[model samples]
Target chain A: MGLSHQSIINMQPDVQLVAVCDSTRFVLDMLEKYTGVRVYNNLSKMLQSEDLDAVIIATPSKFHGPMVRECLEHNLHVFCEKPYCLDVTEGERLAELAKQKGLVNQVGYHYRFVGAFQEVKRLLDIGAIGDVAHIKAEAYGPVVLRPSGSSWRNQRSEGGGCLYDYAAHPLNLVNWYFGMPESVGGTVMNKIFSADSEDEIYATLRFGSGLSGQLSVNWSDESYRRMTTKISISGTRGRIYADRQECQVYLRDGGNLPDGYLSGWNVRYTTELTPEVWAYVRGEEYSAQLDYFVQRIKAKEMDNINSFTSALQTDRLMRMLIDDSEREPIAASGDYQPLAKGNSSWWQRLTNAS
Target chain B: MDKVLFGDNQFFGVNHMSEEKARAQSMRFRDTQAMIDVLDMAYEAGIKTFMCTTHERIGEVCDYFRKHADRYPDYRFYPGMPYAHKYANAVTDHGIVGAIKRFLPNDGLMDAVVRGGSAVAKKEIDGIATLLIDAEMKMFEGLSTPVIFLQNVVTDFLLGLGMKDAFRVFADHVKTRYNAEPGFFSMNMPRLLDVLEEVGVENPIICSNINKIGFRMCGGVDLYQQILAQRQFRPVAMSVLASGAIPPREAIEYVCQLPKIESIVFGASSRGNIRQTKALIDEFMAVRQD
Candidate 1:
């Protein structure tokens, strides 16, 4: 919270950090102690006073929606954390309301702000993976692991589970690299920690380009914070695999430069925090997601919250999956079997699919 | 030698905007119109062959040129159709899996596409076919004079899917049904050759696939570059400056060095850019002759 707060404070020095609010006063006290800012137990009081320029929402999933709404209603430009809300309806409402009020709103799709993913988007546009026949994306980690105790995240009410919480990061990045899929259906399993929220979700999405992809996210692991998200996209020219977290692009043959010569490979690619975030804040081709809100305001681009409706589609899909009664567990395999034929039936296909 | 090609990409036309605010913005911010003005300026700068993507403003654009035809009577303009939109529509309309199943003879593939949500939805497929029909009708009716259909073989599923034989059958079906020359435009050379050989399609068509990397469903930039070098297909190179990233001087210099590189497509967004491009062309020909 200190570093994240300092980054924002440094960016908008003119705007004061009047008060910091969190359910646990420990982090709030920490912010007030370090920054010498006033600490508040209530968000309403903070919004009522303090003559603020904008609000940076860094609270947990449940509080995200109402806090953002309170800020927006007060005509505040908002930069909220990922999974802006637990579900799509509230998120879409917030987005729409933001747009209707002409406010600059931003979601924390931080992967987009990273240079590595930007390079991947550039390569794809330049035909790095040939014609992009298919893509298989897998993200594995145990970031959401909680001790066998009552935590807000483990409960559905608090928006603290695998499908809703951890999976948002990869889902947001996938939508960024590839546009929203035509349709989505997934199988979610909860074998790891057995929380109300799902532990694993196997998702497949088809792009408008006829290229298809499947993604699997699992929170069942005993690794040392290992997050491996890889995307393999095949085209007529060649196949390209991306180490998503690291932003490494592995190609079939060498280009003008050697394979993986584009930029930002290995550990440097996976390292998501710090100097890069600072670089982003400073605005050197990197995204200052907060500054983007300010710039949009200055440019009169903040006309509606609905601008982010497209970004929120994945949230809706997530909620749907969570509400689904029939839970299917897919084997952990990265290999995708390309369809040998085509789909002709909806009901018959579903019944006689085998 | 007798023509200069101009390439412009657009999403919507000024007329599509119904609201007053949008209309005003369209007139001022219309990327396509801005490009056309630049093309005309290039013509004054002595360019003749112009190429463009098919657009909804076909009639208005053609009328704009037809009125000034005497000034550019030698100009050959080709409007390439957007093939990806067709595939997008077809997949949407015929349920992506359904179309693939109908097209692909194998059943196992059908199940994969059915399960794979990325397959084009039935609505998208229908939309594409409808758009194609509309584009085809406009071309046949001569809404644009000698409406050049720059075959969009790059992004369309009609050509990909390893359906060269099927494309041949489809092409013949289109020819018999439509009575029009529908097979012209830039295409994947290998696939085109295969389809042409299988279908006995001997019509001399101009190639428009230049500077673009990869096919609709495969590969990397290196592979595309290699294909350009080794491939037997010779195309009227569009995007000669590689999406206009390379400066005119460098592009001309590079084009001059390339052997059998035929003609170059010059796309300019401004009159000043057109002038610079003209100067580059003059310098290139002078050096080539010398």
Candidate 2:
């Protein structure tokens, strides 16, 4: 992601790569040489020294809260990576701090900038699918294969698990569409990897008046590389499908689809879905996201799609689901029960089924 | 342990023939308490064993039995693993990582985590498979789980892929790891029996669809009958009503009359249905004994 940001920033004349920081000097030297950007060994020293309009934090997740707090205090527009922090309270506090400071703040959830998903949100806004009943969000990849590996991502203490590291992308996407869910349940921490953290997460969510959702993420799949996140929204009228590079829209006859897209299933490739770009990288998402963050800072815009508060909601939701799943198994839910079962006649079966 | 083991398909929505009925059954027992109500009905009617798919709700049911162990001292759970759709759902919702999470152990979790990590690193097939079984067995802690069955989706999928050794591994692990007998559900009983026999899983308990109407009775009904008569393995009749197409009396009578049939498993949501089927089974079994 840092490399991708460099590729994006290379094309943005307005956003200069002034300085970078890391404890590892070898990698830092390589990066400094490649981008001709100055390097600092410490974050605090770099913040005090660099003359910058904004700072992009690509640090480990456990430090996101403190780093963001530091950046806001420095009055710099901030762009931290996918997860803002390990838990909810820190995320909420950071978001509040950003709000009070009147600063432009964003989390690096790049999926929201994907062209295909943007179209998905657009179609949903126009009632293209009509009253989504449930959304199945899945992301699979062969990121971690072997049991023996040591990385921050494999540690639960570092806020590294499939849930926060990989599933956070799709969770953010769901938050984009549905806001805060009413309740989140189902397990989200089964370890397929030998890492301290889980390699998979499965969660069922309830959102706004009858809107249900399923979130699944797995990094142990041998088939995919990196990840392929796909969401299928089953709605009253039809369904919408979105992946990283392509989208499929299946809608009823009355939707406001323009041009060649008909009432039935319409397949769209990235070329058709993507907006015209001034700079193209491997994916337009990185370029678009960085551009949006920089532009917002220039315009003095405190509000943005991937704002701190939105990331906080997603962080809170993920924390809630994990906590709920880890709770003791209930002997009884004690929800309302059916009054009585009539005779198992064919007519009664039909009525009961409906 | 009981002759009539209750199935869990009725608690979770799983009707092979009709989505409408599956949904109805699903909605009817949406509340785990509703499931408890039906399960209580079955227990009170003297059906003490539950031959169940290890769906998420079964964990809840296991919790109930464990908490009130004294209340239902004789109750037993025959856990069926790889509740296939749950895995599919978990994979979809959590991806491979999240799906693995669904099977995470609440206890000895770190040991399992380390083993899972090392197993992946070592690519030890048996290690990973056993870890998964441990995860599935986590919910039945301190409860009676005398028999553990492999769900047919995995059984048949492995069979088709000619992964017959998986059956042996599961059987051995069930006996050695959990001190329980292993059961296998198959779509084709005759073929599964042959595979089990070849794998040296001797006299194993096997469940498959078997009824007079040949409702999903794969590998030919006569072949199943011939095996039932001649084979030494235990047979548990399932899908006996063919998803309620056949009447309860006829289904019970046919299965009971079959040679060497050890038990029958069925799912129903009502007390009347539970008692009605139990009475028919008791009547026919009494006659068979005579």
Candidate 3:
């Protein structure tokens, strides 16, 4: 992720990558040697040595809270990678601190920049799919096919496993569209490969006005070459389905449909929906997100997309998922017998007769 | 470049339009024999160039081609370098230095390692880039790789970094080291053409999305059409079918009518689809030439 930021920063005409700090000596050495960028092992030393307008944090989840706080203390703008902070309270406090300090803060919820997903948001804003009743968010990947040695990603305390790594993308998109869920229930964090953390997560969420949604994520699915995030919404007037590549909408007859769309199925591919960026990497969304952050910093704007407050909402929802998953299952109060167990003798007699 | 090149996306479960079909294709081609069978189909159908990624599985394909050299006398490979996921997974399993060590070609292992260190010490970005490129090209050693391509992921990445010199470095290294023409795959063809021109790569081969719907084509269809008409680069069209979104006839017709398309690359699992697509390209190209 740091490499991604470095590449984008190098490309942006207004920005200059003065220094990079990482714990890995090899990475630091390679970057310093190949790119001629100053390298540091300690964040404090880099912070003190370099005069910078802002900092981009692409470290582990556990390090984000302290790193972001320290940067905010230095009165610098910050662009941190997604899964903003593990702890909701700390995320809230940091959000407040950034707000009070009048510093620009953005999180790397990059799906917001994807053209197809953005088209979905626009259509929903226009009520093209009128009164969304339910939405299903899904993300699947082949990250952890088998149990491997411990890494920050596989550890619950550091990278937060699939819940934070894989699920957060679609979950962030959900929050972006719906704001926040009123409550969450039926949450399950199941482990398919990793021993320390959950590789799959499922949850049911309730939004305001009886709007509900489901979140399903699995990182151990070997069927996908990479992470695939998708969202489908069913509304009273229409239904919409979207993934990274395209968005498909189905509007019922006699509904207020947006222009360029009919009262039937409509499909928009990412190519047509996406506007050309100044530069591109793996996807336009990546460079777009960073460009947005850089522009906001230049403008000294406080309100922006994917702000710390918006990320905090995602963190709070993740916390709700964790708490919901931890609750004990409802237990039967009275003696209850299984029908199969009670009727086994009769079934055996019928089998003997046969 | 071949007028029509075979692609390897279907064998690797990379359907951009639908995941379900990707998964099914992935399951169908899990074995090397399944892939070899399709390659045979493509070969027998007179499509000689196999434009493929340097996935680990492709190493097996290379080995099979080497072992059975007589079967594919005119087979040519246009390998795209530094399969990003392979490197990403390698970096995960083995840290930076270890991953570099693991992928370095074994023949000149010690020398490459030393050069890697010295390249760092001298702050020579080109040396390191060439070293990595050599590592990626190891699988295609001893094979006829007339046109080696830098995959879009890295090409566009360097483009994003505004590293025009890197393009020159790659082109020079590919020309001098391997005696192959350097091709670039990018999502943004117009911008890449401008950059390549700045780097002084004359009439370079560039592969990009060039379908009717403009699937994955950066700068939209109008900009691409304008560039195709005005630019002086060899445009090899990929995703010409837009992941099956456009019908074969329309897709082929769209690209065939374009001014400067040097080639069209498409992937299919069956001999029928392969034959049908090849026939369409042939008919359209013939018609357009007339």
Tens-digit lDDT track of model 2 for B156-274: 65564345777888999999988999998876677778889998999989988888766455546777789888889998988888666577888789889988778889888889988
Residue B86's lDDT within candidate 1 is 38
Among the numbered candidates, top lDDT falls to 3
**Candidate 1, superposed: residue stretches over 4 Å from native:** A1-3, A6-15, A144-147, A224-228, A244-246, A250-287, A298-300, A303-307, A323-354, B1-290
- Judged by whole-model lDDT over C-alpha atoms, candidate 1 comes out at 0.54
TM-score of the candidate numbered 2? 0.52
Q: What docking grade applies to model 1? A: incorrect
- Total clashing pairs for each candidate: 64, 24, 0
> Model 2, which residues run further than 4 Å from truth?
A33-35, A254-260, A330-354, B1-290
Writing each residue's lDDT as its tens digit, candidate 3 over A121-219 gives 999999887788999999998888887887788888886699889889999999989989999999999988898999999999999897999999999
lDDT of each: 0.54, 0.77, 0.87
Order of the predicted models by lDDT, top scorer first: 3, 2, 1
For each candidate, give the interface RMSD after superposing the true interface residues on Cα.
23.7, 21.4, 3.2
Q: What's model 3's TM-score?
A: 0.85
Tens-place lDDT digits, model 1, residues A80-192: 76677875778879888888887788776655654555666677887765678677766776555544554555566787767666677677667766767676666545646
- DockQ for all candidate structures vs. native: 0.01, 0.01, 0.36
